[model samples]
Target: MSTHSYDAIVVGARCAGAPIAMLLARAGANVLLVDKATFPSDTMSTHLVHPPGVAALRRWGLLERLEQTGCPAVERYSFDFGPVTIAGTPRPIDGAARAYCPRRTVLDALLVAAAVEAGAELREGFTVEEVVADGGRVTGIRGHARHGSSVTEHAPLVVGADGRHSAVVKAVRPGQYDERPSRTAMYYAYWSELPVDGFETGIRGERHRGWAAARTHDGLTVMPFGWPIEEFHANRHDIEGHFLAMMDLAGDLGERVRAATRESRFVGTSELPGYFRTPYGPGWALAGDAGYHKNPITAMGINDAFRDAELVAGAVADALSGTRPLDDGLRDYQRIRDEEVRPIYELTDAFARLDPPPPEMQRLIGAMHGNQEAMDAFVSVQASTLPAPELFSPDNVARIMREAGADG
Candidate 1:
């Protein structure tokens, strides 16, 4: 078998790994990246970049490249629940930046390119078999070293960015992470000329039907929401039928979404997480979906991946530069990932736990009565600015009550 060496070996060169490798290499580390798939491929993601995520891309100097690779800037997200249509201003970055929807098919390839340009050696189509470690500490990883090559390679640091079923994680911390299936799953696809109807505004998409749909610059419409996995499994034979039916149930906007398409296929995905940890050990750490799979509503998984890559890259740089203990650095990595992003996860989970409102919620909803600011608050809450519990907080209500009392 062939053999090679590097300072770090990163597996799953997609959302997480590619970025991490690039950042580490830019910091002047010798990096080797591995992925079991070809570039410009789709990952199991909704692919909607939030503003903060867009900011991270800018920080990475990959934003312009992303735009060149068919990224769609989304401006507004319209929520339609049957008869009520609530459209809110899309949150912008600084004054001009807006979130974009880029197909992973486009994004991943661009990322791999960036990593390569940043002086990283990327080997795609090389399946990672296991993590190679020394003394219960991460040291290297063993896998199909190159496409059509059974060779193996080792490095000082092994990074797992291979998404949910990370082989690196399975090998490094076997039997460590436990996951809970998401309450809802989705069947979505990309389109070339489709639109989300009235929300002609692009970027962070607006709805056409009751479904949450957005159009990418490449004209891809991503429709995702909560639906049972069992239902999805049962309808595999006619997924398109089920998808259309759900859109119909959603409303005419959904019907518009259904009719707006001429060429498209479905992508199936399930969201699950028991707050998976054990993300770091001796000579390695995990980044992106490999460590934590988020509830979909947050739309922050990819964003979190970028954020994690930055943190993990810094951890590695510090460890390699003799500035800190690797273990301590990784623990700090986990703390940041777990503690800092917990609110986003919790917020998304709250949306996942959505049930018909109680009478009290109905009364509050009645009070909103078609106010744009009310809807802005709603969107901001969903986007994880306002804490989940505080969305309907007593103090907020008290302030509103005082204002209404004075107005009356």
Candidate 2:
């Protein structure tokens, strides 16, 4: 039992949870943020922060700290589609012409530090044992500390910032929406001295296999990923071997990786289903992977997490300040999140299937060459700042063709 009452209790103190708690505390709400894992610890992540994600960090006042931590800036993008390569600079986000890939160890710790500075009480190494429910509405949580003490904390709202297998999401059992089946299994690791020339590269390999490589936190991260689901299950026992084999299939990235030092153990997942669960209920809400998750094929997880933190925080703040009903305010967060993410979710889901590109896609890829503006638009889809339709629309196609003189 606890006498302390917080306005919000956020579980899982990573990208999503920490920011939500930080914003709440900054709005003068008493917030408690807890995580099972300690800060400065590495978790499995693709780690690329795209331009939109960088903008979110800037808005949260953490981008300077991230830049200070020695994470390299990625200024360009290269997409190798076998017959064609589209190379261009990513569009700037609020004057930031580059993206970043900080190690999760560094990023998470920095976010937690910001939350603490904002007056959120962050409890690392604390595991939520159960969701304390009263009359069918979540009132608090019972959790145990790493060193073995049980404590209960109460709050008006309990947020599940936990990842895909979120305890808070499970306990609440909120209705699900936009659920899509798992498509691609992915494996990735860090390497040293794998040269990229400050460009992040995405290689579309033959037979539907693909790989992405980018500079991040003193090393190069290369991920080999693809589908058919069956292959993932068959290769479960020999993941490292399978991962290396997949990387070997990755055209130019394979050669560079072969020449570089393997600096870390390979990490990956066989299951990555995409979905959006209703983020809020009676007294509980979800954010990050718990509320909405898309396939990592687009490398949008961290960025989306950052974006949703601002959204959820705003909604919660509005409700707490008596500007709107809590449920209505939280629903606004869900609606906006859906509107912003659904397109990317569908695009990434399509990519994750490892299906053969349609003839139209092949033509579109060919069209991007020799046309820098079209190429930039294409890269924006990857950065997530531009919607998929923006590149594929008829008007854009007409302009691209005009620029290429193919329309004539």
Candidate 3:
């Protein structure tokens, strides 16, 4: 048994946790980032970075490092909305740009390494048992080390950056977190020895083939589909086979998938949602996906996580400097994160409702799908920065409403 305390203790060390821990550590706070999994582990994601997300990385100095790590620059983002293929510049707003494609495995590992370098103590392969609270305030966490040895760590602040199903979140914000499912499941993998057509220019193979990036990582193509869970479960394995079938359906995409010498294991995930609203209490705060786990319909995971890390870092930095109260700093963290995600989630949730194509949303997508500049901004709206009205701007959206014969 061991007992120790710090200024802050962050739970979960993967995508969300690691980055937040790194940010606070670099600011000179004693931080510990705990994860149940080891580094370089496989994570499920479409792995496409959005414009604002990429910009956030550049601010954190991770963009330069990612480019140095075989990450490709992405200049084009096209969407095959099952009706039309909307192709546009990679940025949503003007002067916005980001790198093309990088696998989550590599991206996450890079962030973790950066966190370690910044002086964060990472405790992997450890299971969190409970959160320690003092008079209605969270003060520490109880984690079981690998050998089942019990360890307790105290901290004035405890951060929950632990991804979607965060254990720390469960311990802290059980009632404050509310989320609505996006009704979409994702399946992804990698391939080599296959030359993908229309994808040779991008990063790896292709992404968002159905609705995401074309090629990213080392010739790896990721595909995601929006299907009702109960219905999708009936043909889950068949769905994986269907994904392979599509890659083989197109001549270039087909030939590449068929001839690949290296193939990554196929993975599937369901319940990717647009759950926001975190619980920020005294001496405790939520970060990353824990704070605002948005719908992945736009593939905003990596960049969103990076942005959250920065948000938390700035807040923690302020608290450490005695310029901010811990609770006040946390509420600031919550407010900023919520504000950033609200607009994007609005667009994403509205986009997901296209099965019946609600009149207004139908008009929106129909109007902008043809304009490349509009399309870039369209994607930007789903990216967590551009306001929702920007997408529905009278001038920007006038074309569609005109086509629908709705004037004035």
Candidate 4:
């Protein structure tokens, strides 16, 4: 087996891993980025990068490249709840007033290229068979490429940016908290000529059903519908029928979808386990879904991954460069990550249950109807650009109700 060494080894090369590698390499760290799959690959994703994520892309100087790919900017968000359809633009984040839904095939490849260009070593098709450890400290990784010899690489810091089922997490056995069982299952497919103005989410709270549609790359719209977890197995055999039936509940959106042509086979999962693991331990650290995962109901995964990549890269660079102790830097990464994401994590869990809103929430929804300012703020909360507590405060709710001529 061949051996190699680096300052940091980043496993998984998608949104989270690629950016961490890019940022770390730019910070002057020797970075080795490996992934089991090669570039320009598609994975199951909601694909919506909210405004905050778009700002991250801009900061990294990759936003223009994404725009060049012809993925349309989603400038508005609409939430349909049988009784009312609240449509508005979310408050901008860092001057990025628009969201995007680039196909993962395009987005992931772009990120990997940025990482390589920043001087990170790329090892595509590398399967990490083992996360080598010594004296309870992770020291390196052991893996091989397809049809290639096994090799081991050592690094003081090993980052698990591999999705939810991360191998490093398996090896490190990070303690988990706030864990929740899967509450919903979703299936989606691409459709050609499916015209949608922007991001649309429909919630049939009474029936515990929800669906979303967004225009993606190459004039295709990606539509996803979800059901309570209990219904996942019962509807699995006939996903197409159930998917259409659920969309039909969206009224006009359903009409348009039924008239369009599906361009891809259905893909989905019921394995979305929500949790937060101790993000750092000894020489091993976690980022992206490996450290924290929640329901995709809010489409926050990509945004959260981008934010955490920046956080983790900074922390890792500080530690590796001897500007701070490794434990201190890694701990700060966890602190900031949890602080920034906990609110959305809780909201995602609540939405994933697919339960009807309580009477108070229903009242609030009604009060915001026809009030563009209130509607924008509400959508901003869902977009995670605004804190839920701020929008849900009694004063704000009462003000909205007053403006709508409804009882507070």
- TM-score against native, each model: 0.86, 0.95, 0.85, 0.98
Residues 1-408 of candidate 3 have per-residue lDDT tens digits of 355668888887766778788888888988888887777876766676767767766666777888887765766555444444455554443345654567767877887888899999988788788888889888888888788777888998888877777777777764544567656565666655544322222111122233333556665655454444445576576865666555543444445556665466657777767777564776677777776776666666776677677767777889789888666766776777777666666656654443444567555767666666677676555443467776677776776567545555
Relative to the true structure, candidate 2 has a C-alpha RMSD (angstroms) of 1.8
Tens-digit lDDT track of model 2 for 227-291: 45767778778876766676666677778878888877767887788888989988899999998
Question: Could you tell me the lDDT of residue 139 within candidate 1?
Answer: 72
How many clashes show up per model? 9, 0, 16, 0
Candidate 2: how many backbone clashes?
Answer: 0
Off by over 4 Å in 4: 1-3
lDDT per residue as tens, model 1, 280-327: 776777898888876665577777888889989988889889999777
- Tell me model 4's lDDT, rounded to 2 decimals: 0.91
Against the unseen true structure, what C-alpha lDDT does each candidate score? 0.69, 0.83, 0.66, 0.91
Candidate 3 TM-score to native = 0.85
Candidate 3 Cα errors over 4 Å, as ranges: 1-3, 92-96, 193-210, 244-262, 353-356, 359-370, 382-385, 399-408
Candidate ordering by TM-score (highest first)? 4, 2, 1, 3
